[model samples]
Target: MVNLTDLLTDLAAESADVDSLVAPLSAGDWASPTPAPGWTIGHQIAHLAWTDHVALLAATDVDAFFASVTTAPDPARLVDVGAEEFLAPPDELLPRWRAGRAALAAALAAAPPGEKLPWYGTGMSPASMVTARIMETWAHGEDVADALGVTRPATARLRHVAYLGFRTLRHSFAAHGREVPTAPVRVELAAPDGATWSYGPEDAADRVTGPARDFCLLVTQRRHRADLALTATGPVADAWLDVAQAFAGPPGAGREPLSTRDTTVSEVTA
Candidate 1:
């Protein structure tokens, strides 16, 4: 069985990191735009805070959580609802976010084993729930970091995110109303600590090999597949790169593949 303790620990650390990084931002900074298209820094934080609160409810009191949620008439616009609902002065939003995240970390860590928690699109085990939270933190943290001109380095915690990405391949495919291919594809990633982390069967013909940071970036929709140095083989595997998403939701419009121009051989072969 997967250990939820380690996953929760990592999530807590990552959450704290995000909190510290965003703590220094001024009202002007929070109003700045992020890499997430039209979403501003405040919007990003509000989204995280709102989701954190919901996750806490799911972990601790599933019935109340369900009862408390008011479904929007338009489901597609639901993501926008949280931002609008949480719109407040920076001081108010910040404290709500801080409380929400802390509550989430505590609730998730205390969840009983074998319990399934409802999430955006599917139910998640405590381990999967925490991993998904960590993935969200790192993904949005990247955008927040980018807005602040800070480079967030990759960490071994990515092993869990990569695990989630590979595990969700079928979901990603199915979300598009397409059938998932059964043949396994190899995922060989170069971890930052000079170690190789791999997924899928060793004998599988399909393969995706690249730096770990790049793979995480690709799965999170933080970078277009073309922007990263990853190689895929086999038609199924090759096509998967065109639409890879870790976090669950509607089939996302993956970022556009960028031009392979002014590029070096190392960039391709690395």
Candidate 2:
């Protein structure tokens, strides 16, 4: 089992880093186009904050959380709310967002070992919550960074990201109407802290080996797996890459090549 405290600490650190990056941006920068089709930098941050709120509710009362909230009508509607939610002049949305995160942290801290909480149509234990949060933050952070023409600071938290990638393999196989591969694929992540984290079987038909950050990027669909130095030795490993999804949803439509230049916000919304 994973350590909840360690995972929470890592997630908190990454969330704070994401907030720091956004706090200094000019108003115009918030609306800059990110890689997720029509989402903006501000939209991405707001989505994170909103998800934290949902997580808090889910931990305390799953039925109410799902009942009270509705997904934004469409991608454009979601982006509008995401950009405007915390920026509205009078209310305490930012404070609420911060408080929600604090509550989420507290919930995780206080949870009994192996206590499962509702999330994304499944039950995740407190330890898994940290993994989910860290993966989400890092993945969305990449969207913001891609919009700004900047790269985020790499970190060892990416082990969590890689694990998320590994977990998604089962879903990927199922989505394609294939049996989940029983053969384990080895994963070697070279973390930013100079720590190496490995998972899966040592002598298997395939392997995925790369810097942790790049592995995170690829699985999240923020960057193409081919662009990184990651290798896949078997058909299952290659198939996993083609359908891997870290977000809560159906499998993505596959990756498209990213433009070297920053995409225009108008182009995305159009």
Candidate 3:
């Protein structure tokens, strides 16, 4: 059984990891552009805070959360709009994000058992919600790390991200307007501590094998498949690498490979 407490704890640690990255930054660093097009470090945190607040609403007040969805100015640009609306000076935005994530943790912990929290186009259990939070935190943290030219070691927290990525395979295909593959795809990843993390069937013909970090990067759309050392066997697995996405939204224009990029920083479609 999935343990909410464990997932929540990992979520806290993931948030703290990102917080540590930003907390030491000077005011000017907050404006540093990340890999995400048009999004600064500040915008990344703002987006996290905004999403946490919205998630908190989903957990505690379903009506209000849905109301915000219906009233959004631009559904397509909702993520950008949320980040923009919550963007602030470092001192202010930092605290806001910290408090919001903490509150979201508390709210998710106290949610009724098996209750599904309404999200963008679907609903999620509190555990799943927290897992998604961890995934997003790691992904955006990657952006922040890239902006600062810092290398973050892969941790066990990547398990949550990898799992979410594997689970969202169908959503990825649907988001790209492609027919979802019916074949099972096995994912075998080498974890950070030299352990293996396997998902899907043991005998599945379609399989993806690689370092866990690379798979997470691919699913989060943080890096292109060509940049990663992942091996995909079978046609379904091969096609998946091109369109894989762990996020809930339209197909993201992912980053270009290093050799193809005009500048040092890889350009990603907003």
Candidate 4:
């Protein structure tokens, strides 16, 4: 089982970073549309805050959480649910989100050992669940940051997101309604600071190789595989590259290739 201590700490820091970005925005700013079609900055954050609240429920009240999530519309259609329900301006909306995220983090940090939490897709241990939240936090945070025309620094926090992407390769395939190979595919990434991170077996016949940044972007669907510097040596690895997703839900409409620039954002709604 993954020890959630460090992961939770990282998650809290990531949340704070995103908060800092959105906190200074004006009411008009939150209302601005993002790279995601039909979703304003407010809608992006509202989705995070709403999911945060539900994550807290998964940690503390599993049955109640299931009931509410089941009664709500499909996750895909719920983007504007929180923004619509809160019915407040940016100042009010931001505060509620801050409170909810803080509470959710605290609850996850304190969850009992070995307890599995039910999520929209698979059941997750505390660390996996929090890591997933951090992944979304960073990914959605990217969308909001792009909408604001702001560039944020990337950190080792991306390692967790990358790990999730590698670990969830099977789920990603299944979500696409495709079967995944049982064999493991090796993943080797060059970290920004010149560290090497490896996943799967070092000697595995199938391998994915490249910078961790590009790998993270690929898994998050922020960049299309063709736009990244990744190389896959086997069929499974090659196919996985075409449809990698670190987030939950059905298959995502991953970002399309733009120019050769890696810094630009993709309009993928996933």
Candidate 5:
């Protein structure tokens, strides 16, 4: 099993790094168009901060948490919580967002081992929460980086992302009403620091081999799977390309096939 503490810590560190890069930008930069349709950089960060707040609440009170949430907030009541919180001037916004993140971290750290916290579809243990949050932060951060035309430094935590992707493979197939492959596929991922992570049966009929970061990027739709040096052999391997999800919830409407050279991000806007 993966260490939840390490996952959460890595996510917090990456969030801080992204925040630092974003903080020095001018107001106009906040509204710059990102690959995510209709969401500016400000909106992305705001959503993260808000999600951290919500997760903290769920960790504390699972029942009451779901009772309070709606598909959409009452627009007439607070149409711009994210924007208002993000634009409260840098001095105000940064500290508050950081504080919220700290609170979330604290909640996760203090939770009893094996404690299940309520989430959107199913409840998750503190361990799973770390995975979910890391995936979200990384995926959204990709959007911000894409908008800025900058590349993020690779990190070893991408193994966590790949793990999430591995878990979502079943959901991806089920969403398309296709049979989930019973034939296991071996995955050997090379981490950023030269650590090799391998999963699945060695003698399985299929295999996916590549850098861990690239595999994570592919499943998260931050980079085209074909753009990486990964090799997928056999029918099951090809099926994975048709429906791969890294995040929680239902499988996504997978993207159209792109040429091997397309590295542009293909995430759906929220």
Candidate 6:
């Protein structure tokens, strides 16, 4: 069982980690493009800030959240619209994001035990909400890092992300208009610290195994499967990799693989 306190703590850490990456940036640096098509580093942070705000509403004010949803701009471009609307100057944006996330943590901590918060497509317990936030923080942080040509070290927080990915298998299939498979798929990943993290039935015929970082990248649609070292054994597992999405949304247009031919030519030229 996930402890609400623990998940909230991890959520804070994940948010802080991303904060550290953006805090020192010059205004111009915020304009750097990320792997997410058309999203700059500013858009990435703005999206996080906006999400945290709405998540706060879900946790504390149900009616307002529902109203916001009902009145929201196009569902398809809502994410992009939110990012644009919430964007601000770095100094102002940084403090707002920091304060808002802190308030969200406090709200979640005080939420009634077993209280289900309204969210897009589903309701979430406080713990589950925090876990989703962590996943988003890390995933968007990956975009920010990529924009700046920085690398982030993988940590055990990936366990939360991996767990969410595993749990969302059905959503992945359904969003893609495929039949949700009843077959259990096992996932075994090598953690950053050389430990093994396993999920699903030991006897399950479908399985995915790989580095935890790669698995997180795959499920978050941060990288193309071809660029990762994950191995999917059996048909369900193989097909799942093609459409897996950790976050709730329509099927993402995942990043394209780095072309081997282009890479070789660049290498030769250098």
lDDT of each: 0.78, 0.71, 0.91, 0.82, 0.74, 0.87
Q: In terms of lDDT, which candidate is strongest?
A: 3
Quick one: ranking by lDDT, best first?
3, 6, 4, 1, 5, 2
Ranked by TM-score, the better of candidates 1 and 5 is 1
**Predicted candidate 2 versus true structure: per-residue lDDT over 20-96, tens digit per residue:** 77777776777777766666676677677777877787788778766634554554354346445644321244456
- RMSD per model, one decimal: 4.8, 3.7, 1.4, 2.5, 3.7, 4.5
Which scores greater on lDDT, model 4 or model 5? Answer: 4
Q: Write the residue-wise lDDT of candidate 3 on 1-270 in tens digits.
A: 899999999999999999999999999999999887788999989989999999999999899998989999888888889999999999999999999999999999999769988998788999999999999999989988988999899999999999999999999999999999999999999999999999999999999999999999999988889989999999999999999999887888888886788423553322
TM-score of 6: 0.95
- Supply every candidate's count of residue pairs whose N, Cα or C atoms clash at under 3 angstroms: 0, 0, 0, 0, 0, 0
Give candidate 4's whole-model lDDT: 0.82
| Deviation of model 5 at 13, angstroms | 1.4
Better of 3 and 4 by lDDT: 3
TM-score of each: 0.91, 0.85, 0.97, 0.91, 0.85, 0.95
Ten-residue region with minimum lDDT total, candidate 6: 261-270
Off by over 4 Å in 5: 70-93, 253-266
After superposition, candidate 2 runs with Cα above 4 Å error? 68-93, 176-178, 259-270
Question: What is the number of residue pairs that collide in model 5?
Answer: 0
Off by over 4 Å in 3: 262-270
Clashing residue pairs found in predicted model 1: none
